[model samples]
Target: METTREGAKKIAHDSTVQSLNQLLEKNYDAENGYKNALTETKSAQLKPYFTKQAARRSRNANELYKAIRNLNATPVEKGSAKAAVHRTWLDLKTAVVGKNDESILKECTRGDITAVNEYEKVLNDPEYLLDSKGMIRQQLHNIQISLKTIRKLKDIVD
Candidate 1:
């Protein structure tokens, strides 16, 4: 059964990686097309907006990552635990939003940092078990991994 589960996990990871690559490729094409259009246009005023919009698209991608983390990190139990997770999620979401609006990568980094912090909180809580929250925390970890790669890519681009 463990082998079977491991096989399934491998298949799932492969599929997700393939899909993510496709999405990134599409985004690259779209960004290039927009930049090309910006280049040909006579108006200089519109270029900044396009540049900002592209940045916003990247920011939105990070926001989506946070949302995924929040969804996965939601406590299974209600009451105080639920409230706590919800509050932490809100704080993380707010940080992402505020950072994105300002076009700052720090916001996304902070969001990831907040997520790790909240995950640690869940780990420390007696109500939540490590095993029970394993999958959810793993999903949250994916966001962290993706954000790290995104930051690296951004650095290369800049």
Candidate 2:
């Protein structure tokens, strides 16, 4: 016997958790994507950067996991299938396009852009809880910083 207000509250909270799970999935994708980049990256300079990015993604995923768990939802512990397909496409593109650090940088940047958009989507939703909003903002900020880092790396080599 839930009142209308209580029902609305539950709906909002559930949506917030759902949003967090979506973000978590992307973080997992980013983590694995970076790992794959590391294996394909030949540049000595880029390998360390890729490794650091992968670690950051993992940390981001952990935060999302805890956040979702706090809301009593089972946080998704696996990467999205879209990520594997994206990687495969990138691999094929690399064969015809460029295999150099420049090309890899482009691909990584694209992935980061996708991650940023996903975060932005949740941020734009008014239904999301405020506490989780703070965490999402921080993650989005970190992703932006990584984008800048990639730009700087490009400058050094170009």
Candidate 3:
């Protein structure tokens, strides 16, 4: 029979894995969001920015995947199905409204906010492992940077 301590540890580990997977999904969504923005936006100035953001998000996902593997959990290989549906909605909205740079920036900012929230949840959870905190902090920092950039772009558009 599992001891109480062992059971507690198992629960903590499971919670940590679930949080990490959530972050990974957000990263995947951000990557796809930036890619779509890059392809859809006609602004030469914004294309390079979106390209860089996409690459950053891909890197973030890789980092999260490694962290999840280190915890002996299998990371999610793709973004959430909800995110996919949201992307489809974004595409339809863009097609109907015209691919305005401001609108694209707004969408990207929303994605960043989602990522930031996921990371914050993991960071704030007392059950999360200490070793993983550093990695989560780093990922959060990167997401914040991207958010700031997106906001700056939005300001420019405004």
Arranged by TM-score with the best first, the candidates are 3, 2, 1
lDDT per residue (tens digit) for residues 1-158 in model 1: 46987776656544333333333333333333334334433445445644653564354334434433443432111123333464456457755763222223343345445545544554454433233345445535654574575466446434
Better of 1 and 3 by lDDT: 3
Residue-level lDDT tens digits of model 3 in 1-158: 99999998998999999998998888898899999999888889899999998998899899889989998899999999998998898778766878788888988988889788878988999988787889889889988988998888888888
TM-score of decoy 2: 0.92
User: What do the candidate models score in CA lDDT, each in turn?
Assistant: 0.43, 0.89, 0.89
Model 1 ranges off by over 4 Å: 57-158
Clashing pairs in 2: none
Clashing pairs in 1: none
Model 1, 140: alpha-carbon shift in Å?
Answer: 18
**Better model by TM-score: candidate 2 vs candidate 3:** 3
Each candidate's TM vs. the true structure? 0.35, 0.92, 0.95
